[model samples]
Target: MVANQNSVVVVMIPLPLQGHLNQLLHLSRIISAHNVPVHFVCTTAHGRQVRLRLQGWNPNAVSTIFFHDLPIPPFACPPPNPNSTNKFPSHLQPLCEAATHLRDPVTSLLRKLSPTTKRLVIIHDSLMSTVVQDFISLPNAESYTFHSVSAFSTALYTSKKVGEQIRELIESKGVTEYDLSFDGCFTSDFKEFMSVQHEYAKLSSGRIYNTCRVIERPILELLETDARSRNKLLWALGPFNPLELKRKDDGPIQRCLNWLDKQASNSVIFVSFGTTTSFSLEQITEIAIGLEKSDQKFVWVVREADKGDVFNGNIIHVELPKGFEERVKDQGFVLREWAPQLDILVHPAVCGFMSHCGWNSCVESMSMGVPIAAWPMHSDQPNNAFLVTNILKIGILVKDWCRREEVVMSAAVENAVRTLMGTNEGEEMRERAVSLGQEIRKYVLGNGVTQTEVGSFIAHITR
Candidate 1:
């Protein structure tokens, strides 16, 4: 898929996180597949990890795609100490600081490109909206912010009426289970980040979301009609998951598959909280006890406390409850490092998922016909959990609020796990998930909603 001399050149700036990078990379692949040249920008560390993760990929197949690495800038706060018990507060400040520093390097790279031959378009993560200003300042270049979360979450953030109501609710009382919408779920740090992001988004020409209009039609309509967002051009172009691509299984993946082969259909639950979510020691103990008491077969991916550290290429040493592994040895498998998540989801034995409700995990679970046990941790996850459990009615909520310190009791966990794995409600949810999964695959693969939107987006940017 080589681009001609006069073809559009897309510059993608992804926030340095596993989920954000994955979404942007998939979007870049879609654009490159359309014969558009893409320059994927990231820090040196992230770029190296991206290259290693996609090592088996044949670059010659996608001749129009390229990666540009920028040196990581120093942050005011030192990196989290490995031995620290408290979780890293937030990754936004450091990421924003780095993006601020990259303005010069990124601008220099753009200036060096042949302007006449390359019609430029910048698509960047919403979190890194600060960097897009520099790129869009270039002559003949258009800019669009790419939101990796759901349109519902975005609408709540952008709507003035909704924002006011949420603020009032928060001021009166903290987030509660009854108030499960985005306004009710945001953490203080996340609220500040969204405030900055929403302001920065005004600088972009438009916005693009990795979602399908069919899945989020009401919210999309609301956003379009809202005073704040009505004038802004928006497009929903996903359910985009590259994991849908078929590949040969490696040693670890094969082992997971082999284990699944022995289990009964719809008997196993797949548990993970994406790459960056980490639980406190007490929380992990409750989860362990809950899983053991539920008497269900499970596969759990356990990462360390340092949420910001990714792709270290070393197995994480997570400390579980005393003799916990031995106690659940016959009933569960604990993956202390990364596992092939997509592989596990598609297996017949994995009937349900225990997830943090990140958009990627939600989309993946729904796409695979696996119902979810929505355990939202932070950021947009609480909103996503509401979408899955309340709006879609395809999963059950594990917890109602976003407080990480409030340890969820083992009894609550046990009940949620049982509801997802064995109860009649769980069966109904599984049926709905399977039906929705078919619709999602149809929309993303065929000449469906996502395909049409992606086409329109490319045409708009190119023009």
Candidate 2:
């Protein structure tokens, strides 16, 4: 296609992580809809994997989209001491390396595409701000970093996760990094994230968040009302949601979805922790046991902790209480190592969600109008749990003492699930979630006033 309008080149620093990938993917569609001849940038190998998947997906070339290939990363040996728990507590560093290396190559590639390729939107995740800062120019060729978290959740994250780190980095960088016990200081990740974010807000042409302003009205207004930050921050982009799907194995998945469809309306509880977050062998067992004790119909989807099938394991017997599956199997207690989540949540039978309350999952659950049992695991999840339980009034929080990150025992899990699955409480939660879901749909549809204003963000930057 010839350049009928000013061209926009969207650069996505693709992580092996799922939520980040899904956010960038949603941006690709949005950029395309805006009439920009958008090109997606991904790692050489991941790019190949995407191509292979898409070939299987669009055998008929139904969708008109293209991905730009960048240099392949060299294979590196495994970390000297690999503790899955502490492993890559800073995955952001490598992504920073990726953006630094990929930027020039991407700019050169985009310019070659057309004379009207006036700007570049780099959908860099919050953790990878170092990569974004290196980008030389903004107004002519701009970059927009997408916070995969809501601004409020981001606020919470900054308060706890990010700020704690900044304090550590300031107070005792050596102590915080080296001493395992000293490293246990819990503050706010979202605060330090905002430090990087405010910096990014200044340098970039515009700020893009993967949240609808409606849900986080105060946070959105706070960002907008600031004399320091005005149109620079943009929201109301989309549902920006994701699902697990495989084209080659679509048949079996479709069958599972079909079975879910046949079940009672709002009867199933969905449980997933997403791809990047891992549950230890111990954690998985407790979750299984908890769900069993809850005595509710469930469709639990646990991503493999390591490389292999979990079904052959004691997922039912060892993971859950003995004979639990046998008892509930008749009630349609479907268990899977993975699931087509977006499909499952959107399914009519899905009454509630039992989630790690990762930001994307939080938004998706809310978007689908499915009330949630917020079992927040690591990172910004606890803050999102707070948002869901307190701010939204759309769902209930399954908290454990003062310990938000504690592995929820079977009793709490049972009670929480029972609450969501039971009569009066469950009905009320479903009603609230549905009402909020409709409000969020406006951002995804670009029909809301706040969202439509986002399109002018580029213009605001130039002026």
Candidate 3:
């Protein structure tokens, strides 16, 4: 299944974090299925993480997709501060800095692969553009910047008012020269990281979004009309995780799914913040009390946030309230590690999600027709919460962004859980969520928008 000498080849350079790596890996499978050879490049450690944790399709079976592992020098890996007043996960800043040192290895690999192909297409995460910038000058190498966030957040972030506010906030904290903004979520170093990315993105020949027109038409339209995006070849090819891939899980995962099978239809709520959100022990106690008081059937994933290196091999201890798990044993199930999120979302008994509104989780919840209790924690999360609660009308806000620094009281969590799972308003939101999911399905699964856009991208690369 290797490409012939004259065939177009694609190389993927994804940011080493979970969310970013997952999207580009999915895209690689899509492109490889069309007979294009794709080389997925990353550090040796992250490459192992990708292969071990990849859920649906088997990467080994995909002959056209190859793995290229590059080595970089060791850097410090710090754990995220669970109680930090600034909501951003600033501890991840060092990882981005470490990735920049890959420039030499990446450049060498690209040059070696360039001469054998008709075209060498480099599809890199928008934030990882610095790693590939030097090789874009090769005669046969063409690059596209792949944006992993939602279209709504991206558009809102680029607006004048939001941009200025973020700049002032960062500068007040001693940052001086970053161009992109995420409103108080990024630290000085993170701003510098983004500044580098923004500069290199201008060199890309096209832009790719992990979004579709159905759910984000207005936002996508806005981006298309924006001056920065004008005249660039834009493609919306997403809802990327295989919607219908049958997964086989055993042990704890199987038991979790079995528990879901026994619950009444639409009677359970799924509670989890993505990997990067951690709460103090006091906050965890409040969340426990809240869910218990709501008296709702639930499955909650409890784990500490990731360190700067996701594979740092050091585990931080995270504990629930003493005797609390025993008290709610009949009413709730608590999973202590990475739960199979998509499987639980698609289950019949799960009715709502209490989430951090991370973009990947938001997309998965929307695609599954599950309403959300939006508890935004940082980065694009507040904007995503607004999109879910205000724009999509498929969710309820659990925490106001203005009060994000305060611990959310148990009463507030209880009210939000009850409102999203037990009220008539919740039912109405469920209906709308289902309807939206159906419309999105038509585009991503049927022969509609996503198919056409993906086909166009392949045609562009091969033509």
Instruction: Please tell me which predicted candidate would have the highest TM-score against the true structure.
Output: 3
Better of 2 and 3 by TM-score: 3
- Residue 191 local lDDT, model 3: 77
In order of appearance, the predictions have TM-scores of 0.87, 0.76, 0.92
Q: For candidate 2, which ten residues in a row score worst on lDDT?
A: 177-186
lDDT of 1: 0.74
* Candidate 1 structure quality by residue, lDDT tens digits, 46-92: 77655544422444478888989888665553333333232333543
**Candidate 1 regions with alpha-carbon error over 4 angstroms:** 1-4, 51-61, 76-92, 114-118, 161-177, 180-194, 227-230, 305-316, 402-404
What lDDT tens digits, residue by residue, belong to model 3 across residues 1-463? 3345857989899988877888889899989999899999998888877676676688999999999988878888777788887867777777778888878988998998898888889999989888899865799889999988887677656556444443454467565633343566667778778878978988888788887887777666556655354567778888777777575767467877887888999999999998788898889999999999999999999988766666667677688888988998778889877776888898889999999998888888898889999998888888788778876899998988877789999999999999989999999999999888888878788899545889999999998
**Order by TM-score, highest first:** 3, 1, 2
Ranking by lDDT: 3, 1, 2
lDDT of 2 by residue, 131-190 (tens): 456556444456666677667655434335433443354344233321112122232453
Model 1 / residue 430 / CA error / Å = 0.6
Candidate of highest lDDT: 3
**Model 3 spans with C-alpha error above 4 angstroms:** 1-3, 159-182, 227-230
What lDDT score belongs to each candidate, Candidate 1 first?
Answer: 0.74, 0.58, 0.83
Off by over 4 Å in 2: 1-7, 48-64, 75-100, 110-116, 132-134, 137-139, 156-202, 227-231, 242-249, 305-327, 332-337, 401-405, 442-446, 449-451, 457-463
Q: Compute the lDDT for candidate 2.
A: 0.58
The local lDDT score (0 to 100) that residue 1 gets in candidate 2 is: 43
Candidate 2 colliding pairs, count? 16
